[model samples]
Target: MLSAILLFGWDFAMRTYFPEDETPANMASREDAPSARADGAIDVGNGSAGIDAPQVVDVDTALASADRIIIDAPEILGSINPVGGRVDDIDLKTHRQTVEEDSGPIRLMSPAGTPGQHFAQFGWVGEGVALPGADTPWQVIAGDQLAQETPVTLGWDNGQGLSFALRFAIDEHYMLTVSQAVRNTGTGSVALRPYAFINRTSANASKSTWNVHSGPIAASGEGVNFDWDYDEVLEEGPVELGNGTDWVGFTDIYWLSALITQEGQGASGAFRSTGGETYRADLIYDPINVGAGQTVTRTTRLFAGAKESAVLSEYANQGVENFNLAIDWGWFRLIAWPMWQVLIFLFGLLGNFGLAIIGLTLIIRLLLFPIAQKQFHSMAQMRAVQPKMKALQERYKEDKPQLQQEMAKLYKEEKVNPLAGCLPIFIQIPIFFALYKVLLLAIEMRHEPFFGWLRDLSAPDPATILNLFGLLPFDPPGFLAIGVLAVLLGFTMWLQFKLNPAAMDPMQQQIFMIMPWVLMFVMAPFAAGLLLYWISNNVLTLAQQKYLYMRNPQLRMQMEKDREEKLRAAEREKADKAQE
Candidate 1:
């Protein structure tokens, strides 16, 4: 119930304050989005809202039939459309769609008219002059293909002596440099403002939730901003990103597509909602006056690729302000960043993500070993004194203050701190949250295999008991999908609890007894790696409990006595009930 409330609160907060969380079914085409108006005013939005939709076709047909430039780089592979000159078709070479070996590479961008139409285009927006639209057939005059060492230059002529060119260059990773230029050779001077916009439908975007932000994200001159959600953009209309806007774009859990304006250009932008369930990020520069035979050029970089941590950071260090912040680390970034580094180091050393996770657990356990030892010894001491404590409690049943005082004295005499066991749990809260964020956001962990039947550690355990681990024909509902690791987690936790001293309150003891199974059901749908960690921790705890028992014979003896007495009392009660 508390978790539900927190989630609701988070959603409410994002909707109320930042409100950019929305998506629609159809989108107004780029041709409909005239960058400027005839009244000598700049709108940077759709002129004729929701008109001239593209023909719906499969991505393969669209790419095969169109005049496009192939993108062949170290990490990226895609084709650039020539008609609109949009970098739309992109797929990661190394990342696959699923754990299956035959699964295809992960696609990052798709062309317009497709079900997942997402693309970035650079062109001119001017009044009283001809400009390139989505239908402008651009000719590649410089290079046949886009490679790390080779760049492609696309040119277009308005037939009125105005020549336009878009130079495209790519790095080894994901950044693409698009330089937009306009040359005036007609008899008269022309005023033109260069603009770039990323248009997409929300139909295929990742679900936006309270904690993990999806949709419009930005890095202003001040810092990285995640406040503008989709709903706000739809309700409030186009959001004007004032001057000092460094970069702006859409972000998913593992993907990002943004436009970074040139440094010191003071380039401004806005996120506009075209009539359909589509949106656009427009990066606009001031209008430049080009005299006859003169030219104007503006350079902007488009980043459309995976949000890899190391890659993002490297870009950030090279002057793309707060680029790494694209990977939402939450408020616990201080702890999470270091933890991520350690995890990466372990993965490098172990060569398997599952083994790396186990190694991380071992390291954490070793670090907290001393505290846990103290906790167990303290618990044992407290248990050894329980009989005396209970006797005093009964004597002072009507006087609670007196009971607490005597309890404190008894605890002091026994050298046991009542709160010792709680310290380790409190210490683990930050570590647990850090791991949760890291695993959920890291694309590198996706499709990583652990062991038998655990092909994807980032996903829930696929083998569930309800279906006999795939022996049966039916699949279980989420809550009932108890997997092998979950079962082991429950048993190991229950065993560890059974070794501990019994709670004085019957209700508390019953809760402790049931908690393991409850957690097992609750956690069955979470990532297998998280479950593996808990299971490993529980097993270590049981071993620690056993070792501690040997070191404290009195505590072990009392536990045995308590168990036998409880069993004998249960038998007597059963016999009495039978007689009655």
Candidate 2:
């Protein structure tokens, strides 16, 4: 019931606060059709907006069919498709599809006709002016190849006295600057609105996790940030933001492509999913009127590459307008961000992410040492009063209230809080989740190798015991994929439980004994780095327990006495059963 209420409340909050525009089906009849008006102003309705529907074809066919210009930046390789002059194909030269050095580069964008058709396009929507369309084959007049030092310029003329020139400049990294210059050479003035869009025809192929966002995300210069899933965009139509310096784009687990502009330079943009596989994130500027023989230019930037933390921070620092918010830090940003920074620092020192995780765990344990000591002392006190507690339980077995009253009185008299042992666990929960977020979201952990049998700390341990660590022929499924680290984690957990004070109830004792193994299976699918941290924590806790037990001699004596009595009782019962 509580879960249902929380879910309902969350739904209500989303609908009320983050309300989206009407669906495309509902708006189709109300809005103008997606085409140019008689005055040459493009009627870019919410859905199916700005341009004609793309034809379905393979990526190779699309690239082969277009007259393409090569893009040869230091970190990126792609082409400028003359068919609409779109920055269609892009591959990150630094990142590979696989860990192998010989693997292909990571492809970020593809031609419009591909299976995963995705591309970034820039053009103009104008009134009584001729603008480039999807079929317009732009003429490359400047450079043959786009590079860091050399820029590429594409030109087109409407023959009615309006000429358009697009100049593209790229940096050594992944930022692209597109400057659009419109010259009015006609007898009359023409009005044009510069626009940029990122279009994706298919959903992301990467596995989507609930915590990791993989869809449309936007941020404004005014500090507003919003994100939506693909289905939400489809159901809610378009998300309209008022004019401000803003950027909107799509983000997968690792890559991002956003269109950015300065403050108050353009009209507020919209992130729209056209009620199908087609999705577009676009920014349209206010109309610019240019008189005859006058030229107007507008510039926008594009960020398309891996979402690295330092790189994103640099861009954000360089006035990119909340660009660092692109990486989904979730609700735990306060904890997760610092944790990530610490991990990066430790990794730089240790040269291994696994070692860095171990280092982080050690630091956290040290910080929580005082609280843990209190919990351990309280547990020892509980152990010392175990006999008295059992006596009270037997005396008040039939009276539940009386038993609770007696327990409370006994706790008060002994100065022991029964809930003290839970404090450490409560504290560890947030740290555990924060570290999980760091491992899952930070790109630094991707493809990082640990010690033997742990090639990827971000992924689950691959070597399964069921396959005898790859010696056996048959492979095991996910449930049966318990590896060496998982087994060690279970063993350490069992040791930690055994070393601590035993529970008073038989059912509780049984549960404590069974939980470690159950969690071994449950945590088998978690990252190996997480399992390593858990194991390290358990070991530290076990050591702490030993020290506490040594210091509390009375508690140790009581536990030993209880153990001896249980053993004697068992032997006596055995002898009696044999005689009978």
Candidate 3:
């Protein structure tokens, strides 16, 4: 862990400390665009930074006819990629950040940053009328525009060994497009292969960044991970723990790549992420003759939209690494996606939002019900045979060997399985972890509604103002609602502990009792969505156990008989084997 931290620290330091060249004198300041300040700075109205739509550039002008153009401007808004901020409430408050002109690479104002900050890119609009060309079959025309309905054409330079130009544009709906024109200007033909890269950095420059916190725990044999390659494939490495830079990467041609290769010359490709972010890079790298000054041009499109597998599949099929649902961090795919999908599916099936949560809880209970029943049945059998076992213990109290022998005989006769209970919970451990991750990362629950007072299921219940006595502790009247939810969580947890006493051993009980307080401290700042899931799950489990207990008082007795039958069958099988 220490070593991982050090490595991550070293990587961050290099990125943060690496000196960037000054902005070119000829280049127009981003603030020069309409609604920008004359001095090239963002105007904060009334001490608040209002979100301003990004400046759209003429595609033809930005990707003007040029030879070997290197667009190294640190902060070119539309030129950078797109991102969705915070998905997990226990983690960080998600929002976009303010743009600083000094930021070398265009910064994505995601969670932990300011709010409403965005860069337009490719978008999806279900099977309806899209933003004009959205549904239109895209070609290498790679035309760009500064505003709605205006089109601009871009060209490449002649005579240069390698000539490439990039154009930035936003369609009517503000989706981002970065079209490139790459050409091998030399006499000999060569492939102008394209690759995309991504990295993480702090937006605030004044403050020294100690570390960037990310993650819940990791599974065994897996290391702390992050996307290194723009491809978004999660590869395992050494366990990286602590506050520092962690990176993961994958090649584009791998699974989920949307590249359409044909006759060694591919044109117009799109890359889609399963996390709902997509980037399209078109290739026009056709062979050219130097003497005649011929060149090939390529253009690309990027979409920062939904992570629905179907959506991604659509883009991937178009020959770009689009629709990849792989979790860029940890075992999110293996754990998070399935869990959230289950919750979402349940919520949709149930008409009432709050009842949907109840339904989800019931489903989980039913799935685990068989295992829990088996465990409880075994425990009952063990307790039933205790009287006989106690007699043997007393009779052989002086003869230790005889007591042990008698105990074994009693176990065989009564047919009690001591490990039945332990096995069930153990089997559910992976599922528990998967659910935990889903609650942390699923965006489907974001701003979702759960009915009455809980207007937004994705957020915590807002405090309701009532003059309930100063007894609520916080002098503020609104705090009364917060206190109520906290109490409800506590009561439910306590009741669960009381009813399922066997579920807690000495250590487990201590941990359970202590964890709520710790959770309170942690959840106070978390999104209310997570708290709701936990509360609902607990309540549902409590109700299910109570129902089972009431419905079948002799359930344990039946289990004991079943155990005896199994034991007798095993003995008969052993005898048959010996005779053979």
- For this target, which candidate reaches the highest TM-score against the unseen true structure? 1
lDDT per residue for candidate 2 within 322-429, as digits (tens), equals: 888787788888999999999999999999989999899889988998998888788778887877998998999999999999999999999999899899999898
Comparing 2 and 3 by TM-score, which wins? Answer: 2
When summed lDDT is taken over every stretch of 10 residues in candidate 2, the lowest stretch is 24-33
Candidate 1 vs candidate 3: which has greater TM-score?
Answer: 1
lDDT values, one for every candidate: 0.83, 0.79, 0.39
Which candidate leads the pack in lDDT? Answer: 1
The alpha-carbon lDDT assigned to residue 442 of candidate 2 equals 82
Give the Cα-based TM-score of candidate 1 against the true structure.
Answer: 0.89
Of candidates 3 and 1, the better by lDDT: 1
Worst 10 residues of 1 by lDDT: 46-55
Pairs of residues clashing in candidate 2: 39-128
Ordered by lDDT, highest first, the candidates read 1, 2, 3
For candidate 1, list the clashing residue pairs, or say none: 19-232, 20-229, 20-230, 20-231, 21-229, 21-230, 21-231, 22-230, 22-231, 24-277
Assess candidate 3 and give its TM-score to the true structure.
0.51
